[model samples]
Target: MIEIKNLKKVYAGVTVVNVPHLEIKSGESIGLVGNNGAGKTTLFRMILDLIRPESGEVLSNGKNVSGAEEWKNYTASYLDEGFLIDYLTPEEYLYFIGGLHGRNKPQVDEYLASLTEFFNGEILKKGKYIRDLSKGNQCKVGVGACLLQRPQLLMLDEPFANIDPSTQFRLKNILKTENKNLGVTTIVSSHDLNHVTDVCERILLMEKGVIIKDIATSSSTLSELEEYFGVGQTTSTNTGIDNEENH
Candidate 1:
């Protein structure tokens, strides 16, 4: 479980995010929705210990996230494109990430084998540096690497940005299966309400760095989420294809 207490972030004398108390239970999938500059990414970074919060603490499984080496083994996160190692091929990148989590090459290869269909034989053996792959393919490779580790907590930011529609659907199913079957807790932030509604059991709406609404998926719909964001008219009905995959 993750417990965030009085979390706050400030940059250049400006407050970005402030959450007094937020707790995410193990194996739960939670979605965060907010407009640009609403500090959604900042919050995710704090949880991952990529950035320091101005105040408060984030604890996972009874250990503090900041400067906690043991917690590193249990948490896996991908915040943006920069997180990928541009010099490595997709297979190499997967192997490197799995190795960091104490998995061998054979284990990485076996995990990649299961995801072969999703890659269409284009990623695993392509022998191209990750920087050379298209953005969509890079997103797929990053997400695939994270899954190979099988961490207990996964945090993703804008995870559907550059993927094709078909792949997005596949990713949704993959996330659901991992969360349900493996009992992995996930926190995903996306502007695509439909994707969040389809996968996450809870949704937190942010406005100007504050959570304006928190609703359970069982009690809310994408349409209602659109209304809450005041973008109902612009909400995509394009069959879940209009998002950037940042997992």
Candidate 2:
């Protein structure tokens, strides 16, 4: 479980993230939606203790995450390409991450073998470094490494961005399976509304650093979000894609 209490962040006199209270129960698949600068990544950073909030706190299983190390044992996140070691090959990167979590080479190999379809035969046995892979392929490597940890809490930002259509389909299945079978607390932020709605059981919409709407995933959820974003209108706003730079 995760809890946010009066969380706040500021930069150069402007508040980026502010939340009075929020709770994420275990085994929940949540989709965080917002235009760029809506504070999606800022909130995520606070959750992982990557950035210190100006006030309040984020708790993982009742333990404060800020300025603490214990939560790292059960948490994993992939915010961007910076999370990857650019010089290593995909195989090397996965092995290194698995090793950090006590999975030996044989164990890592076994796990990698199971992802052959996800890899699409391009990620493994390729002699190229991660930096050399296309952006979509690199995303695959990074996301794969995160799942290798089997973390209790998993977070991914803009996971569908730059990914091919086929791989995006595969990723949806992978995330749903992991959340359903392993009960991982999965939090994802995405600009792709359809994909996010397909995978997440709940949705949180943010604007100007605050959550304006929080709703369960239902038959009308996608259309509701589309209406809010003005999907078919000429004067459409934000679209949840333009605000990418702010996060």
Candidate 3:
């Protein structure tokens, strides 16, 4: 389980994110949605301990994330290109990350074999560095590496941005299977509403650095969410009218 308490982040004298309390239980898949600069990425970073929050605490299973090295072993995250080792080949990178999680080479190979088709033969035998791979291929390698350990907590930001539609569908199914089979708690952020609605059990709506709405997918539909985002429901009403005219 992950618990966030009074989390806050600021940059250049402007507050970027502030959440009083949020908790995610184990075996749940969550979707975070917001316009650009809505602080979704910042919130994920804080949870991953990649960036420090100005105030508040992020706890994993009751341990403070910042001080919990054990928690790192259980958490796997992929955000952007920065998370990948540009200098290493995909195979080497996967082995390295697996080693960090205390898995041996045989264990890594076993995990890779399970994701055989997802790699499309590009990641396993390619001798080229990850930086040399195409953006889509690089994303595949990053995602594959993150899943190698079958982590307890998985967080991905814009996981489908660069992939083709087929691969996107494959990934969505893979995530769903992992969540159900392994009981991995997952959090995903994406602009694709259909993808989010299909995979997440709970959805969080953000606007200008604050969480304005939290709805269960079981109780709400994506069309209703589109309406919330389309009109003056949470933020400014006139902005919705302007958007409608522009459309």
Q: What is candidate 1's lDDT per residue for 1-79, written digit by digit as tens?
A: 9999999887667677889988899989999987776778878888888789999999988788896878788777777
Candidate 2 lDDT tens digits, 22-137: 99999999999887777898888889888899999998888899666878988888988889999999989999999999999999999988888888988998899999999888
Candidate 1: Cα lDDT at 80 = 73
How far off is residue 67 in model 1, in Å? 3.3
Determine which window of 10 residues in candidate 3 has minimal summed lDDT: 238-247
- Cα lDDT of all candidates, in order? 0.81, 0.88, 0.84
* Root-mean-square deviation of Cα positions for candidate 2 versus the true structure, in angstroms: 2.7
> What are the per-residue Cα lDDT tens digits for candidate 3 across 34-83?
87677888888899888899999999999999998889878888888778
Q: Which ten residues in a row have the lowest lDDT in candidate 1?
A: 237-246
CA shift of 213, model 1, Å: 1.1
Q: Pick the candidate with the highest TM-score.
A: 2
- Clashing pairs counted in every model: 8, 1, 0
TM-score of each: 0.91, 0.93, 0.90
Cα RMSD, each candidate: 4.8, 2.7, 4.8
Clashing pairs in 1: 159-245, 159-246, 160-243, 160-244, 160-245, 161-243, 161-244, 161-245
Q: Which stretches in model 1 have alpha-carbon errors above 4 Å?
A: 231-247
Q: What's the candidate order when arranged by decreasing TM-score? A: 2, 1, 3
| Alpha-carbon deviation at 212 in model 3, angstroms | 1.0
